[model samples]
Target: MIIEGNDPTVEPSFTLSNRLARQLWNWVWLFLFRPSPRPMHAWRAFLLRAFGASVGTDVHVYPAVRIWAPWHLEIGNNVGIADGVTLYNMNRLRIGDYAVISQGAHLCGGSHDYNAANFQLIAEPITVENHAWICAEAFISHGVTLPAGAVVAARSVVNKTLQASWTVYAGVPARPIGKRTQHEH
Candidate 1:
């Protein structure tokens, strides 16, 4: 077999201790956090804080939500992460106060640089501003930012920034559908 130029077994950029801690936390997440009842949001938040996540007050992360690398996560007050939501935060991921990540929504902060022969990992920060809503099953790609009060419709895929505040976005690439009025809750 021909030898490849790049080493496939090369370790990721993170420190060994960080990786080990995350692996151990996975067990704690599954056993302690996942099986807990809905009212245990505070307890789960406490556990997340113990793992180095900066979680604000009254943030409700449902039992089925999956968070990769909790240390990279920063959530503000009153944020709600519904069931089946996935936060794949290989880089910094910030959710502002009053943000809602609905059921099955995915906030992905990492991707592969396909141009590299080794398929190198690329990471970027994801930000959801205050009062933004990510609807059910929506996918927010790396480096994407949702402005304050912006709304992403169900099953939408957002690959770019939703710049306008109080706007509604939908569709595969997530185009701005309409503006949300202040009076409309």
Candidate 2:
């Protein structure tokens, strides 16, 4: 859980360390990561690695992408995360090799338990398997797992684990719309 408190109504939601780290990261992002040129993928990767992220080779993470916590990220080889993407990784978030996270996509890794009196925070892992495509402006909710070769259509919303591989899902609360032809790349 991101926040653990007996009485959240009065207590702080995040720990002091967590808040401090995020403050430091925000400064780094403003001064270094966000201002860097688009082609400097390796440099950005290096910065993320320095902050405890496990990033693989040939990963293209754009300068405009917003990452909540680098320590919660694990990205594999050749994964392309485009500009305007928001990776709200309050929990562990993984992107497998060859996955493409299109521009404006939002992968949220945390939520609140509405049933709780204080609406307790709940952090859950999110996974995008190899060759998966999260299309432009899509919203992926907490604890979701997109299987290998799965495609989420533009502006789609996915809140649960996808069942099939190589399938195309679309619409709100995305459903399988078609099958994608799997190819070895």
Candidate 3:
């Protein structure tokens, strides 16, 4: 399966018209705002919303938060993305309900194929399941599936599929460390 690679129907190299518009918009936004830190609120929401983020009701995004492309982010209900959480989602990033992404967490949805010519980066969709807890400073790689109620411990590096619910994962390339509060779900 193509993890987060654009849907097969979509072309990789954009036509001139599409490229111009995208460049123009990116330039406009970059020019309009200085890249600096500040408190976040409705303005950020408006900006993300404008970029095509399917943000659900009352979703909280902090200022100083960086998103590569808002258009690819999809969050379900009651998701809490804490301050400094970086979602570098070039492809689809699907977060289920009540997912808590803590501060400094990175949902990296792009990586280069080291063996490929020029090491072209490939984007993959990340699926964070319902009621999952990605603790502070954790890094989740592209195409990873955090099953429902999974708990990723702080500073963990997750690169594989985790299926158990409410289980704690921590390590470089994270593995199960312990059980979580949730069970049978």
Candidate 4:
């Protein structure tokens, strides 16, 4: 409900405090978080936690991953977010345990309302359930939920909530291509 029906011309999409906090976070990310060594996962987690992110134990969020707002992220235990991933979580983005967000993947939790004259920004939550594997370069749209053990093939574009668990999805508007072997994690 960030900017649901408001006109962008008249009012700012984000509050002044929010903008200022983001600016501060950008500086911190550039100097402290982004420049950290690849093996310094604990340090990065500490930095993210300081900025209000709920990062669980042994989470492997790579150095090149770009997170728009740390406060909106909730990463569970053993989650692996690889390099070049963009987490544009304007709203809450929950990543369950054992979830793998591969390289160059984009998880966008916000979009613009095209029908609105002012193009109001719409923020929605995105959930990646336990053991879900979002393959390399995949794009997970706003409000979409990937159920447990779902495998999104490389470069797939998922704009809707996937129906089946333990399934593999591929293509532009990702459809279920096959079933994945469900393994206990």
Instruction: Please report the candidate that would top TM-score against the real structure.
Output: 2
- Taking every candidate in turn, the Cα RMSD to the unseen true structure, in Å, is 4.1, 1.1, 5.3, 1.3
lDDT of each structure?
0.89, 0.94, 0.76, 0.93
Q: So what's the TM-score on candidate 2?
A: 0.97
lDDT at residue 99 of model 4 (Cα atoms): 95
lDDT of 1: 0.89
Q: Candidate 3 lDDT, tens digit per residue, 56-134?
A: 7666666545576677878877777877888887679988888889999999998877766445557789999988999
Give all TM-scores, in the order shown. Answer: 0.92, 0.97, 0.78, 0.96
Where model 2 places Cα greater than 4 Å from the true spot, the runs are: 6-9
At residue 153, what lDDT does model 2 achieve?
100
lDDT of 2 by residue, 1-185 (tens): 25675577788778889989888988998899999999999999998998899999999999999999999999999999999999999999999999999999999998888998888888899999999999999999999999999999999999999999999999999999999999767
Model 1 weakest lDDT span, ten residues long: 1-10
What's the true lDDT of residue 159 in model 3? 92
- At residue 182, what lDDT does model 2 achieve? 96
Model 4, range 32-120, lDDT digits (tens) per residue?
Answer: 98999999999999999998999999999999999999999999999999999999999999999999999999999988888888898
lDDT of 1 at 171: 98
RMSD of 4: 1.3
Residue-level lDDT for 92 in candidate 2: 93
Which one wins by TM-score: 2 or 3? 2
Candidate with better lDDT, 2 vs 4? 2
